[model samples]
Target chain A: MARGHPAGPTGPAIRRAFDLLDLFTTARPRLTLSQLARHGGVPLSTAHRLVAELVRWGALERDPDGSYHIGLRLWELGALAPRGQGLREIALPFLEDLSQISRENVQLAVREGAELVFVERIAGTGAVPVFTRVGGRFALTATGVGLVLLAHAPTEIQDDVLGGRIERYTERTVTDPARLRRMLADVRTNGFSISDRQVTTDSLSVGAPIHDHLGQVVAAVSLVVRHGTASPHTLAPLVRTSARAISHALARRR
Target chain B: MARGHPAGPTGPAIRRAFDLLDLFTTARPRLTLSQLARHGGVPLSTAHRLVAELVRWGALERDPDGSYHIGLRLWELGALAPRGQGLREIALPFLEDLSQISRENVQLAVREGAELVFVERIAGTGAVPVFTRVGGRFALTATGVGLVLLAHAPTEIQDDVLGGRIERYTERTVTDPARLRRMLADVRTNGFSISDRQVTTDSLSVGAPIHDHLGQVVAAVSLVVRHGTASPHTLAPLVRTSARAISHALARRR
Candidate 1:
């Protein structure tokens, strides 16, 4: 949060570099140097110099059109994230099995601070559309995976989220803190979470926790189906079993 | 190439930070601060300060074990890379179709400089075992997709690769420049590339190019099967058709 403080240990130049990289997103993957300068709040010359350095370092790639894009090198580095590709690779087969049997949307997610990040998602054909993108973030109070992760999260993170205003996506979303608190307790007691049309109007998701070798809940797995097509009772068992299998696989691999 | 000049436009501190991040690989995803300092060629104090800033910025994550690893933020950024997850997501359904029909390994790769980076790979159960990893790099001369990418790459890149020492993975790997040039020409002429026991002794791969809206070969897709079980002649049409479908989908999506 330091803006141009010359005395901080975090060098201003590195912070500026981070600013440039942060400007890139799924929506704006390609940007001209002028756009980078405007969005990054840096001068055109500064942006030019920083972009040149990033291109040389293989962090940002310059296209034939003279626009910049997130490069393959950054993706290669991101592949080393234990909670990203590492976890996704181990859980993929099990996630595929869940998707095959249920023929619905299957997702794997991990809590990042007070929010949730989707690691991987597989959409089953003819299934209800779910607006989930891989490596995208969602609020921790809405979907099934988000609810499960929030339930098992540390108290501080939970408190921060619970005390803050929760965004309601649909009429069925539970935004009341007291009721949401009880929902968390029930998720703990029932060993799974069923978010009935909480994230979207027609999709219901069943999520279960995936534990680590130390028995800590490291991630959550979920299956999203049409609200009337499948019962949460049946889907929960399949998701729970798959999550357990993936947890065991993770443990054995390590 | 700018090793340790303090007067360069690219700050040495930022470069050192990149060096620290570059150390984490699939083989070693986590490292202590001491290891980072040693590998990054920075003083312990400098490494500690830089790491603290990176962790605060969510570029690096500090685990409960006190080891640092690539963070979810980086993966989110990587999901923006058009040649990485963006290409993979667009090509996944086709890759799945290829996997289901042939029951063989499916791969997608793009040229990175003179080398090749595997963007995505789907292994067919009980099929040939492959060493390719998603987000992993490989020699451009030893795999089917690699050959297709090399064939379509710029002339300077091809010359650079041909001029360098080509590491042979198996007896079938083409290391001779004249022979490799002929192979590249053949790939361009035939609309596909066949690596007969080039990457591994027991496996063979057939690859075809996927073009963008501009008719440029943006990526390559392949199917790897157990050698001698299925002929590349049979797999070529299947692979090429899938690649075409993906190319069409990419064009339509934009």
Candidate 2:
């Protein structure tokens, strides 16, 4: 109730704290206090107090150079997320096996709204280079995993993705809604999706859906290789088998 | 201004929100609203409002069974943590190489206060089963990585760890402070540390420190194998090489 005591409506403070956290990203993982305050649209004094509290709670860490970063404690808490590490941990072995056999990049992803979040990725020996990173997000119309997720996604979500301006990463990227709809239909009919140089010029990926115990398509798995190195038809069954193995593992866990 | 609103001391509310988050751990990754209220020691109405805010911000998610879980957004945010995924991303390729070469469990860890947190782990085929999870915490006196981290830690931290109650996981675990002190000294002098069945009677681990550009030990890497299958002297050099490779990669990044 005291004035000028860093006391106010709890909602704004909590939102501001999270806003400060959101300023950190893959491109800019570290920031000074002044930068945080400026980017978060808060006063220096308020940012100072909030940063202190976050540091005390181990949500933020101060580096030796006087910059702030997301702390290890947050990583520990995030590891408990079922859609993230929980799913990755279950699928990692099968993915590793697939990557070993195919010697290509294998990825696990799940739908989040109109986009997809990569849960895990295993880079195989001498595999084609991909820009995807673990915990990163991508449009649901580019990558193989994204296509599989979008195909099985609810109708509203599919419409939202198709109706939005789709990013064209390469010339082969299908941005037309009619063509994409047919691609989704093929994915459903064949239980697999092929993204031929959709995300990159020299790479192709085949993806398959992972069903949970209730047979809901909760996640997707994919294998990416050099465009000319492997045939999509040959790779689809491998990716589909790996996805089924992961689905069975998930079903057994519950 | 307004009475009977959710307005309160922002500090207490922030602390209470984090407290609610802390209640969800590896053992209990999901909680109902009532359970969160009971465990977090808050009123049911307060918990409801806070949970709603958290869910709106994507910090928590509601499962179909009505349990709240840590959300994917937290995992995305946590990926920016320098001590957690940042370190792991740079060290993973080398850890994978070591895992392949040794055909044993490879682990990466960093010290947090008096404990060490596993940053990354690569499980090798047919290796001895170890009880370490990524983002999980462990003592600073048991595993090889723990000993290396404690040896390079500040003197105050070393004293705090040595002076506290050390856990004895197996009969082979050395609980004597004097002996542990000697082990720490050896780790500093030999550029590596070895734990002979300290955590598990069936396995042995060798660890080496990974330094930053400043030559300060920032993390540790380890390899674990089944007891009597290999010599620690042979494994020490491999782990030390992998650690140095990772440290060099880290230094090159900045």
- Model 1: pairs clashing at backbone N, Cα or C within 3 Å: none
TM-score of each candidate structure, all chains considered together: 0.93, 0.94
Candidate 1: tens digits of C-alpha lDDT, residues A168-229: 99999999999999999999999999999988888899999999999999999999999899
- Residue-level lDDT of model 2, residues B1-254, one tens digit each, is 45576555434567778889999988899999999999988889889988887888888999889999999999899988988888998998899899999999999999999999999988898898877889899998999999999999999998888998999999999999999999999999999999999898899999999999999999999999999999999999999999999999999997
Per-residue accuracy of model 1 over B1-254 as CA lDDT, tens digit each: 66654643534556777878999988999999999989877778788989998898889999889999999888888888888888988999899999999999999999999889999888897887887788888889878998999999999999999999999888888799999999999999999999999878999999999999999999999999999999999999999999999999999987
List candidate 1 stretches off by more than 4 Å. A1-11, B1-11
Worst 10 residues of 1 chain A by lDDT: A2-11
Interface RMSD computed for candidate 2 is what?
0.7
What C-alpha lDDT do the candidate models reach, one value each? Answer: 0.91, 0.92
**lDDT of prediction 1:** 0.91
Model 1's CAPRI class is medium
After superposing candidate 2 on the true structure, give the runs of residues whose Cα lies further than 4 Å from its correct spot: A1-11, B1-11
What is the DockQ of the complex in model 1?
0.72
What does candidate 2's lDDT look like per residue over A37-126, in tens digits?
999888898899889988999999998999999999999999999899999888888998999999999999999888999999888889
